[model samples]
Target chain A: MESDLVTADMVEATEFPHLSMRYQVRAVPRTIVNETGAIEGGLPEHMFVDQVVAAASQS
Target chain B: MALLQGRDRQRVQSELASLANPVKLINFTQELACEYCRDTEQIARELGELSDKLQVEVYNFQIDKEQVARYRIDKIPALVVEGEKDYGVRFYGIPMGYEFMSLLGAIKDAGARATGLAAKTKAALATLVKPVHLQVYVTPT
Candidate 1:
């Protein structure tokens, strides 16, 4: 959220039915990081940041 | 019908009062084929009414090719929360229910030209040289 290198898009699963199917979204608040890793459900702020950072750090 | 009720309206108004700069909600929608386009545009319009610092712009997703390309919008009912410069924050679909808070929060962040991410998180993000795309999938409920 603080970096210009990051772009965060909140996608409404129902409205974007095709995207939902593509991402295999089975529940609300699923976060797809770098289009590779999936974070299911809501996480605490620190944990969420950690996961996102880790995902971004991955090659 | 109004999506934001009395208490919700009050809350939004109060939250928007802290805005330090002008923010624009760039809404992309189509006249036909999109089920939630109208509602999404309405949300942008209503939020615009809540603050003088907020501006709402509506563009046809199909007709406005330039804007669509500029914002890299690929979906209908897309809303871009932009301030003086784009921070790459976007909302696709109607941000209702719980996601409403995210919209409000993004507006605030855009207006402030800063995110409330912790110092450590900011530091972590600064280390990234490659682009990171985050798509958070949610339902209105």
Candidate 2:
């Protein structure tokens, strides 16, 4: 989700605990969008798109 | 020893061949007891060497106090990928497996000053009024 509208960061959870705490990541492969939006677990491509759109529009 | 195997190296080289501008990878690492620091530096350097327009700058995370503060780096094995401008792109820890593709993509996007998102997505993104920060968590393996 970077390089265009929003800047995204790939945060290694173990290395950056501060970020994980800030983002409140509880599971692996969690995508925190706009700080407030989040999607956890593996998602299908279409569902992933919907989730991203839903999450982004929420903020 | 080569960090990237033969087939991977070939793939990386080919992918980086079309670089339009220079990309600087600012890597923060320490000499002692840092897991994956050496491996991260090695990969960044190898990628840099593959492309003439790419460069890597390795800095001691503890010793380079000024650099650490400058880049807002909070931990070791951090990489700040810079292209036309600092896009606030950061990669924490070693980008391996699928994550490595993201690294390569970021470099290409930065170097070309382009984001290959779909037109609809780009248009929607243009309408964003507030700043959004994305934190994608993944296990490299």
Candidate 3:
């Protein structure tokens, strides 16, 4: 159910709109976070922590 | 399955053998057999030599339901970092590619009981007084 909302195509379509269509198309199903911003894709732990901290600081 | 073919396996074996700590691999699938076992054991042995504190523990899930439940693992081929309180860090697939570095970092962290955060990162993290739950999913390419 969650996967449907954040399919690779959806991620590519939504996140990096300025990138080339081919690169965007290839980057689908990337990291999709819930409303609370918990990512549901593979990420290095440190990078994950960095993202989380960055998001937390923003809000 | 042997994720590495021939020369790759040898290279990985050599790298693993050079570690100063022991790294453990817990095989949770009954479907895995033979060379997989031998290869994993070889890796574990190498990881052991990596560090004085390194240790590898393999759990064949076919016989260890309690351990699986204790680890809160519901999938096959999962990795658990064992150290002060277990950390709850898990990998649902074989740690390879970029994931291997994360696995090694976790192992070293556990061995040293170290959770290293850069000063700036630590300072930022300290601002979060509330509980935060994070989950990341990844497919090995």
Off by over 4 Å in 2: A1-5, A14-27, A41-59
lDDT of 2 by residue, B11-62 (tens): 9899999889899989999879988899999988888879999989999998
For model 3, residues B1-141, the per-residue Cα lDDT tens digits are 444557865655555544453444444444555223444444454555444555656676677888878776655455666664555566545555566666666666655555575566555556664444333443334
Deviation from native of the Cα of residue B122 in model 3, angstroms:
2.1
**Each candidate's DockQ:** 0.82, 0.52, 0.08
Highest-lDDT candidate: 1
lDDT per model vs. reference: 0.90, 0.81, 0.49
Q: What local lDDT does model 2 show for residue B134?
A: 68
Quote model 3's TM-score.
0.55
Off by over 4 Å in 1: none
Candidate 1 CAPRI grade:
high
Isolated chain B TM-score per model: 0.96, 0.92, 0.63
Full candidate order by DockQ, most accurate first? 1, 2, 3
Candidate 3 docks with a DockQ of 0.08
**Tens digits of lDDT, candidate 2, A1-59:** 34355666787777667778887777888889887888898776557656766777888
Q: State the TM-score for model 1.
A: 0.95
Best by TM-score: 1
**Estimated TM-score per prediction?**
0.95, 0.82, 0.55
Model 2 global lDDT (CA atoms, 0 to 1):
0.81
Q: Higher lDDT: candidate 2 or 3?
A: 2
